[model samples]
Target: MILKTFGWSFVITAVGLALAVLYDGWTAFGIVAILSILEISLSFDNAVVNAGILKKMNAFWQKIFLTIGVLIAVFGMRLVFPVVIVAISAKIGPIEAVNLALNEKEHYKELVTDAHASIAAFGGMFLLMIFLDFIFEDRDIQWLRWIERPLAKLGKVDMLSVAIALGVLLVSSMTFATHAHLHGGAHADKGETVLISGIAGLITYMIVGGLSGYFEDKLEEEEEAELEAEEAAKKSGKGGASAVLLAGKAAFFMFLYLEVLDASFSFDGVIGAFAITNDIVLMALGLGIGAMYVRSLTVYLVRQGTLDDYVYLEHGAHYAIGALAVILLVTIQYEINEVITGLVGVVLIAWSFWSSVRRNKRIAAEGGGDFSEKAEVSTGV
Candidate 1:
């Protein structure tokens, strides 16, 4: 199972290194490997969050997520999306944008930096919504219930998210528009326009994200109903076909929600990666490798039952997400490096792992007496 899971990753790595060798030999290979490792380390929390969703999906969709979903994440979002962003930002044609990246590497950084403000805006708002939803929504778990009642009284986080996003847009627009005379550039007006554009993106994300959440809840309800019906049918010796069909449908919608969640997570990673390198091929190769590792890590989490074993892990990831969202929002007013964002996630996830281990040890020690009692009783039997 492990080999099957990682086989495609190895193939991708081999192909990436082979291409790197053809282009710039061992040095390029090393760079790609290093970048891939860096990306993987930074995205550990992403895998955990993904696992929570992936566990709800059926086997077939899980395969699709590993294959087609990886393609979209690594190639479509990481590679093509950056290029498209560059083209728009630089006010150049696609070919010219490629040429600019290849020839004018130094100037490309400025374009990337300019692009960050807007991308950060969208990423920030989206993540804020995620954090708010998690904190506000009622989960079956007890420890998490404390915040739910208070958050629920405040109303839907989605509504608050929309209002906050619009406020950000209005503030950014006012700043840019008012200060237009203070800063002169090739596209001064374009700078002001980004604020409005970013708000539109945020609104779109809100609509999609909210609808996805609603659908997910509805699916869960339907699955519960089906399960109850199935239980009744088995007791009465009746048909179970309808229940099975409902289960399949529930899994399908769960899969869709997982993909949407993945896309949201990728938005920041994809945009942040452009800061490191503008070469679409290299970006795709590097982030693809990272995406592969994250997928493997997710499967490992499921197999290991990491969340069930380590209670604090999810809480830490959500906290980190919230922090990242705030950082991204602040970047609209002040620049924060992508390295910093990546490092923040790495540190948070590392801390969570350590905390999980500590927690498990404590649990084991506390259960030691019970185990001894059971051993004595068994021996008597």
Candidate 2:
């Protein structure tokens, strides 16, 4: 089942292998392979999160995500984005950035990693919001009832996530300042950098989320009208943006949301890949392979209704994302291992998966062999 949907991933893997062999030999090939696995392992949460949103979209948009979106994932986020980061941070042209990546590889990596505090701040905050929104929303099923119930109750307090995130940023900033001062190096302004980037991330999320939510309301209206065929004024989402703004506006916004979400998720992997190899091309190829598989898994999850089946899967993914967000912020002052970051997500997801399986067995037994029949009505949170 996975193989059929992930055929494109196989093609990507083969192409990456061939490119690694042709360009840098077997060592590079091995590095590419490791990078691919690293990306997949680190980004399983991304796949689930994407699926949660993708299932809301129509088939056309879903295909666009798999096809056009994959190109952006591989080229834009994996390569050009890094070059742009280096270009802006290093005050060099894109070509110069590429040259640095190729020629002065160590310096290139340093430039990339040097910008980590801000990157982590921005991405971590964006992700923290995602996690907070998920757990804060009133879900029917409470996987971790003890933790989630209180959060849900607290969510009624307006801007709880924002307040909590800002508080963490402030504390992180203070800790960062003290750490930099004591360490006696170029870390003097890291706390300030984190604050600025974290705010920018928060703003980006509000804009993107706001736009998407507005369009979603419009789409829902259209969905309601179509359900009754009561009016021709309401256009189907498939027919395009329904004369709302411009052509493809709805889908385009969805596309934007997905791309930004993917970028935030990829920030870690892109930086982490440097630890494995300095070759930008190899990193792109290797990580691109992983990205393709993640996209495939997203599509597979959407088509197979995995989220609906494993009720806690999305919850688990968000919790993993929340942990990652905290870890990213923590890494600003402390050097955290990528392996630990990856493992945290894996462990949370695995526990949730196991819990889901047990849940299914219980449901099956209680419902006299048909779990799906009472699944919708079952109490979950």
Candidate 3:
């Protein structure tokens, strides 16, 4: 299973390293290797979140995610997205942006860094909405009961998630974004830009996430109908039929949501890549390889039923996402080290994993009679 899951990633790693060596010898190769590892470390929580979503998708859609989705992630976001941002922000054509990236690498990096405020505002708000929605929803499993339970109660209010997300956007735009340095220490009030970008982000999340949910509900209804028919057929001595899977509009919208979520997660890593090297080709190779591994890991977790085994893993990933969203907003004014961003996610996930292990041991020692299920219903955090 591991080989089948990670085979493509291993192939991509070999090819990417070869290309890096051919690009500028061993130094470029080493840089690419480091960037790949950095991306993987920063994105471990992403794999967990992705697994939770991908498991709901059908086999065909899962293949689409591995193939078409991979192209969009590696080239569209990792490569083309930055260029598009530079083109728009620097007021230049796409070709000029490409030339600037290749020739004036330092200048290109500066443009990308200067554009960070807008990027942070957009990605931050989008990610914040995701975290808010997750935490606000009432669930049988509460990872942090003290906070999550109250939030869940308040979540009964209409549009609470959207209201809180918009409030955060407004506060950040007025405060942190106003003091942000643009164009390499040239201070300017970025409040207007931040507000506009944040609104766009919030609107994007609403449209995409809303449509996905609607379609997913339809898919669920279809699945239930199929299950009913199959059960009836079985009782009547007819052969059981296969359950319907996510497809059509449902699958497409879900796929779209996944890609956008991936883009939100990649914002920090794409910008942070500049700190390592400004070579566009090298960055694409490195980050692309890392992305493949993440997708592979997602598939592994889903196939192995890791989420069911360690239910708190999903909770951990969401908490990490919340930390990242706050960090992105904070970075609008203060420069946060990439190391801190990466470590915060790793630490939270590690703690959750430990909690899950403890829970499992306690269940076994107590002669488990659905104690795990019972524990999920308990008010303890």
Candidate 4:
């Protein structure tokens, strides 16, 4: 299994890098490798969050996630996305955009610099809402009737997230709107207003993300009830609905959620990567490599049952997400480098892994022995 997995990853990486090399040669290879590692490090939190959803998915969809999904992630989003953004903003065509990125590298840099604030604002607000929902919303399984009753009745659903996003949009818009005019300068040109794009992105995020969450919760509840029923039926020696179908449906949404989560995480990395290299091919290669690592890490979490073993891993990732969101928001006024953002996530994930290992060892010790001892006992040692 290990060899097969590594072999597949090798093939994909080689193919991706080969494509990069075709476009830009040896320099492209280096850029992709570095960017890939950077993206992976920055997105460890993304992997953890994805594992939470991916673990619940059926095997087939999970394969799609690792396979087709990676293409969409690395090429579609990481590579093509920035080019598209540049093209739209610069009022140039796609072919010209690509040519500009390759030959007129400095111009590409200027384009990314100009768009940075708006990207930060949109991505920041989207991630902030995600963080707030996770932290403030009730996720506990209500097993007891008494507790569920009053809790459900009195639980005030917080709209503070929406309000906060709106506030950010308003402030970003007003600030950009007045920035040039107040300086007795020329009127801000179209597609140059950070405020408008920021507000639009934030509003779109709220609408799409909110609706997704609502449906996700509903599906999750249905799945939970179905699982319980199946378990009960099994206890009574009866058959149950195909677990795979239910799992597939559950996984589909989880996949969607994971993609959205990835997009959120990639926001900063995407913007920061432009700061390093404006070669579209190089940017794609580097960021694609990073995305591959994240996919591999997500699978590792599931196969290793890290979440089951380490209770706090998910919590730590969410905390990191919250911190990233805040950092993105701060970057609107203060520039925080992508390297710093990437390092912060790496440190947090490393700590969580260490904590998980310790917890697993402690549990094994408390259980009176290791797996070898249990095996011996079962064999009548």
On TM-score, the candidate that comes out on top is: 3
lDDT of 4 by residue, 255-306 (tens): 7667766877888888778666777777777787778778877887788777
The better candidate by TM-score, 1 or 2, is: 2
Which is the leading candidate under lDDT?
Answer: 3
Which digits, one per residue and each the tens of the lDDT, describe model 2 over residues 1-381?
877889888988998899999998999889999999999999999999999888887788888998999999999999888889889867889999999988998889888877778788889989998898888887667788878878789899999988988888788777862353212235546777778888999899889977887787777777575555634335543432233343256667877898999999998899889878988999899999999999999999999987777777887899899999998887776777789989999988888877777788787777545433343423232
C-alpha lDDT score of every prediction, in listed order = 0.65, 0.83, 0.88, 0.68
The lDDT of model 1 is 0.65
- What is the model-wide C-alpha lDDT for candidate 2? 0.83
Ranking of models by lDDT: 3, 2, 4, 1
Q: 1 or 2: which has the higher lDDT?
A: 2
Clashes of 1: 0
The reply for model 4, stretches above 4 Å from the true place, is 18-25, 138-157, 168-195, 202-215, 218-250, 357-381
Query: How much does candidate 2 score in TM-score?
Result: 0.90
- Span of ten consecutive residues with least summed lDDT in model 3: 372-381
Q: Given candidate 4, what's the lDDT at residue 229?
A: 84
Worst 10 residues of 2 by lDDT: 177-186
Deviating ranges (above 4 Å) for candidate 1: 91-109, 139-158, 164-194, 241-257, 267-276, 362-381
- What tens digits encode model 1's per-residue C-alpha lDDT throughout 1-381? 777777888888888878877877777777678668767766777888878777767677778878878877777766666667779866889888777767786576567656665666566666666666666655443233445446655655446655765675566556543333211132333345556556655775666665655666767777787788889899999865354455565566555556655655666666566556656566677777888888877877876677776555676677678787777656554546767877888776667667656655654776643221221101010
In order of appearance, the predictions have TM-scores of: 0.79, 0.90, 0.95, 0.77
